[model samples]
Target: MSASTHWLATASIQSVLERGGNAFDAAVAGAFVLHVVEPHLNGPGGDMTGIFATADRPGEPVVLMGQGPAPAAATTEHYRAEGLELVPGAGALASAVPGAVDAWLLLLRDHGTWPLADVLAYAVGYARQGHQILPRVRDTIATVAELFTDHWPSSAAHWMPDGEVPGDDALLRNEPYAAVLDQLVGAAEGTAGGPDPTGTAAGRRTAGIEAARDLWARLVGREAEAFLARPHRHSSGTDHAGVLSAADVEGFRACYEPSATVSFRGHTIAKTGPWGQGPALLLTLAILEGFDDEYLDPSTELGAHTILEAQKLAIADRESYFGDTDVPLGHLLSTEYSAERRRLITESASHEFRPGTVPGHPPFIPPLRVDYTPPAAATGAKTGFAGIGEPTVQPDGETRGDTCHLDVVDRWGNMVSATPSGGWLQSSPLVPALGFCLGTRLQMTWLEDGAPSTLTPGKRPRTTLTPTLVLKDGQAVSALGSPGGDQQDQWQLLYLLRTIVGGYSPQQAIDAPALHTTSIPGSFWPRTWTPGGAVVEDRLGQEVIAGLEARGHVVTRAGDWALGRLSAVVRDPATGQLAAAANPRGVQGYAAGR
Candidate 1:
């Protein structure tokens, strides 16, 4: 079973399975297709985090640490010298070392049955031929059309062919990107021996894929170095040059890390280490575990209030300490710590950013909001990042935010959940030669000194991209994730509550209404906070909304089907059965299984 944000990606997974590939192969194929079909959400130059359980080692989950670190020259002083208080959301200056491709390749090489060429074939076809443009893609390009035309001419040429935004029905093509993928295929083909072929299972555990991985790193490093050398207009409304070097790219590599986890109910939830926002979800679950059954029910007035408050407290902790550096995760996830943090939640909403107090370490509180009001000169230009423009849905209706998520579970009991994001189309200027953009993930850092997420060379920004793996009784059971910027885990938490506590099926849990608190400081560029703010789907009804508002929550209804694009796949090893479900909000999501 497999589920993804787009039908094409889901179908790609099924195609892989039909071709006798395993879950890892399907995941690799689907991930590449997501790059083609959901360009607005992710790109070749992006980053990703995944948690997977291989059939050989069922309960042992591994974290795919594809969250690339900042370029060696990306220092706080350099950005400050460029006359910027906060990192620019979309620009060459905000870019990080690209890592998603290498990470996916690593997974494929280590676990997948198919060769590199087979996995990339789907993306190559879609990019060379044409895929129907998503409305959101058209909208994103249109929003940044002026910026592209007036400043980033390379982007204008790529996204806007005739110097105009493409319509939703337009068949969007990226021949350049297809060419890049083809080159990667060629690299793999060059090493493929008579004993192995691209699509055949004979190539399992062969050197051909390793050769392709080596060539890919060298090629991307060379191109990224060349692109960063050229100056581009930044979100600062000024032309700023990048400091990345070929060495920065070549030195970057993705690896497996031990997953951080916390046991709740009868399950153990695995997350990326403190470097990403996964720990926040675990902490929220810990705090909520202390609540009564009634308050834990998310559909009720009291239950909703409790969940929101607990989320706010846990997210505040994320802002304070979670980062790339060595974190005191043991202390943070301790039972004593959970008890201490649970005391912070109250009946009324707490607008304060209160990170927990460790005995030896002092807490670092980031600026409530890094004043990101656009400069007077750039007023005419669209400010606040591309995908994060004014909320897509107003009280009436609007659409906003973008990311790609995939979950796969095979007949062999292997499962994986990966959330790929960062190098979105609107994140940076087009690297014409590569037919993709660099990720502006460096913007998730604080420039201030002594903070865990402070900008430092070779350190990863505290990324919001997080994937989830759930294990019960020391056996792998499910893999789940979503894509909603800071709301990623917040939405996942709701799904967990519904599925684990409310006893809803994966589809029923995902189809239910979702909400997330914006009261904590955001981790995106132009980081800001909203006091007592919460956005909920109207499907929760007026009574729930009224109850939340009466409890001091600043409630905003985002219409029914306006939030969350989560997908999940589950495996019942005992019965050899697999099931899956996808979000129904946008009609783009799909799920498939035998």
Candidate 2:
């Protein structure tokens, strides 16, 4: 079973399944295809985080942490000298080490059934032959046409074949990316000596996959080193040079770690470590666990208020304590601490940024920049969608980002949820030979000293790309995730609440109206805060809105289906049953199962 935000991706997963591949193989195929079909949301040069549970391990979930860290040269003093208050959301200078490809390949090598070349074939075919362009992709390209033409000519050359954006539904091809994939396939085949005829298939395939990984690392390292050596115009409206070297790319590798988990209502929810924003959702859930079931029903006015207030408190702690370094998670997730934090949520919306105090470690609050200006083209200019790159940092001082998610479950009860993001077509100048742009994930780091998320050499950015896995009765049950940046966890919480509390199915849970609070400081560039800000789907009804407004919440009505793009897959260990569901808001997501 597979569910993703695109039919093509779902089909790719189905293709893998039909070929007798396992859940991990199907997920890898779907993710690679997403890089082809959803370039505006994610790309080969991005990063990802995955949570998976294998049949052998049962309820023990592991985190595939592919989030790359800053290069050794990236530092607060260096960016300060360049006159940057906050990192530029879209530029080479904002790039971390690229890790998505390696992470996916690693997962496939260990858990998947298909050979490396076989799993990558779907993406290669889409990039070479062609695929229909989504309207959103066309619009995103149009929004950054000026940025491409004036500053990043390489991007204009790559994205615009004839010096113009392609029409919607046009068959789009990235030949250069196809060539890159083809070369990787060749490397794997040469190293593995074709298909394995003996019983040593697993061992031989793993060796071949390692060879392909080395080839890819060397190729990308060379390209990135050469590209960053030259000065380029950044979103900061200044010519800046990157300090990342080929060594940085070659030395970096994605790793696996034990997942951080929290239990509620008899189900254990597992998430990425504190390095990413996954723990914030767990914190929110812990706080909500203190409330009554009536107060937890998000469809009701009382529930929405309670949810929003809990989110604010959790996200505030996210800004203060979570990062690549060791965080005092034990105390924060304790029952006593959650009860203390829950007490802060009263009858009204909170306008202050408040993080809880831990026993040993005091909360470290970064310097908050309430008023900051990002360097976009003039407001009077004719940019169709201002601030289009990564969808991070709204022109209205709000911050958001886009990503791609895929969830899969095989007959063997193996399950995975992955969220890939960062390298968008609009992220940076295209690498002419690579047919993709470098990711700008480093922008998530703070420039202020002493903050947990502060910019440091070789430190992972506190990424917003988080995926979730849940286990019940010591067995893997479900995997789910969404695409919004800061709202990824927030939107997912509503789904979890409805599913666990109201006993809703995956589809019904995702189809329901959603809301997320922006009352805390945003994690993206410019790092602006919106006190008492809450964006809700208008379909949530007038009474809910009025109640929230009456409580002094500043509410913005996003159209009914405009908010979340979540997808999920569930497995029944007892009966060997599998079910899947995807978001319908964009008319692109699909779910496929037998």
* Candidate with maximal lDDT: 2
Overall local distance difference test of candidate 2: 0.87
* Per-residue alpha-carbon lDDT of candidate 1 for residues 30-56, written as tens digits (9 for 90 to 100): 999999999888898888999999998
lDDT of 2 at 41: 86
In order, the Cα lDDT scores of the candidates are 0.84, 0.87
Instruction: Tell me each candidate's TM-score.
Output: 0.95, 0.96
Residue-level lDDT tens digits of model 2 in 1-594:
999988999999998988789999999999999999999889998899999999899889999989989999999999999878778877788899999999999998888878888999999999999999998888777878777888789889878878999887688899999999998888888868866656486767887888888988899989977986788777676678877788888998888999999998889999999999999999999999988899988888999999999999999899889999989998889999999999998899998889999776668786665656544344443323233334332435432348999999988888999999878887778888898988889988988888899999999999998999989999989999998889899989999999999999999999999988878787766567678988889999999999999999999888777778899999888898899999999799999988
300: Cα error in model 1, Å: 0.9
**Model 1 lDDT, full chain set:** 0.84
